[model samples]
Target: MNRKHFLSSFIAAATVLPTFKTLANTVESESSSFKIPPYLKQGDTIGITSPAGYITLEQIQPAVLQMQSWGFAIKIGDTIGKRDFTYGGTDEERLTDFQKMLDDPNIKAIMCARGGYGFVRIIDRLDFSTFQKNPKWIIGFSDITVLHCHLAKNYGIASIHSKMCNSFPDDWSKAELVQIETILSIKNALIGERMGYTAPAHPNNRQGKADGILVGGNLSIIETLAGSDSDLTTKNKILFIEDTGEYLYSVDRMLWNLKRSGKLKNLKGLIIGGFKVKPDDAGEEFGKTIYDIVSEKVKEYNYPVAFDFPVGHQRNNFALKCGANHTLTVSETGSVLQSF
Candidate 1:
């Protein structure tokens, strides 16, 4: 090639290379810049609101009393007990209730009353300016995963992924209730000694060690938010996912989407939480279990993958700090997930 042709090619490559490098660096910085919210203490007022499905005041009374018993003042939002079809309230009503709690200085933490299918409707309409100034824990799982991913991707604030008011047992002796309280008080998680669980290993499990900020919640929500502004960044991040009531084929499809989108291509680790899938109809099987679908999708990556880690849609659901760094170890014996 002539000097003139070579010169043109060199100049074009130089101009585009820096732009790609800069973009990669920006994404890395944004993913690692999360700010931990202040931990709750006695006398701290907790605000309960429904960002998704409807909940009756009577249904949440047990949770209210539980918070009170823990010495935290409870302020129930107006959205509760108000119904607009399947949602707790109209979009405007839910947005107003959540906005008030976000802006209120006295409410140290915002607890979701339930998670159904409405947070996405009003998530874009709500503002988080005041929330950034006085960051506090936003708690719940499932539909609340929308908030968890949005906060991590945009605002860089950590939130709680745990049982909400709807999941509080009628009798507090259940182990889940204790796990919920331990996370809220932040005594255990703050010291990096968050409660850990063990489960029998699946044949498809990948054994290894990985440490990165643990970020993920319901698999359905994560898949629903994919390619949107709230999509998660799994690069060098420990991605944990759980779901409930999904068909086997549907689970396979969602995991395929994550793999194709490059979300599962690079990860420090992968945790397969409780899928709680529905059984196929008689003789019309989807031909794969939840574990099979997940393992197949992530087969290319060697990161630690642990199955059935006691999370999602079950009485044993435990609290996970959505944006906090954590260490994961997978082996023949079992797997361990602990906050760092």
Candidate 2:
């Protein structure tokens, strides 16, 4: 038997443990068995792999130099700059490059070059054996949410849902830089405190405290992951969801699906991000607001649902860690989620 088992046995025999205490001890020991990936230390090399969207050579230098400014070396993947159709390369090529990076002992981190689409096709083909054992930070949001959801669900490796390579336009601002830095900070596993926005509250609120594995990403992709093992089960979880340019009814349908399937009913907290809501040049309101849609779907539930956390498809968004434990605070001042 393993040393942990042997020691637990020895302790049980010597101490004559109570039944409830023994069960609690075992549950604690088993549930906490999941591992945290090694924090990114300075000077270690980070690999830039385009697991989804394609990136032009023109788009590469700024992302590279950004990492350089942080005093770390970057190792570009073979398929990073290749443009075979809509992806950085063929599906096979993209998977191969990702596998190569995961296989390399020298690569301490993997950052997606961008996130447009094309990851759901290749998620099942990924070999998570090594990744499960040696977890490293996988960074990016949007289509990159596929990788984040896959890694968090299968390998129990926490990943950041944040900025990608193309997020930084030429006309960048200091606020955007700070947002990206918050992401890179979490990439290094430097989760400090419950840092978030100062927002107002909703009418239907489920107060009190509960904590569990934090998980979520784009609403559409998460809905698609339902029935699959990758779906985030909100038995006790702070579910963070965000999206952009999606019609309000589309959001309503997806949330309705999640509601119908019993996914969003038991959530500990619901974090709605800055929706980037805009009326087009024609000045159409689309008949439904994102807030109304969410409130409608979650009306029956009593969970503390807070909106405007600033962690979705917008600039200056906060970083969130899946598979990490967090405490949620909801009040008139707003909700602040602190990760420990």
Which number leads on lDDT? 1
lDDT by candidate, in order shown: 0.77, 0.66
RMSD of each: 13.0, 10.1
- Global lDDT for candidate 1? 0.77
Scored by TM-score, the top model is 1
Per-residue C-alpha lDDT of model 1 across residues 151-181, encoded as one tens digit per residue? 8777767788888898766766654643454
Report the poorest 10 consecutive residues by lDDT, candidate 2: 5-14
- TM-score of each predicted structure versus truth: 0.86, 0.81
Worst lDDT 10-window in candidate 1 = 7-16
TM-score of 2: 0.81
Query: Per-residue lDDT of 71-150 in model 2, one digit per residue for the tens?
Result: 67899888777988889999999999999888888888787888888888788887766766666777778887777766
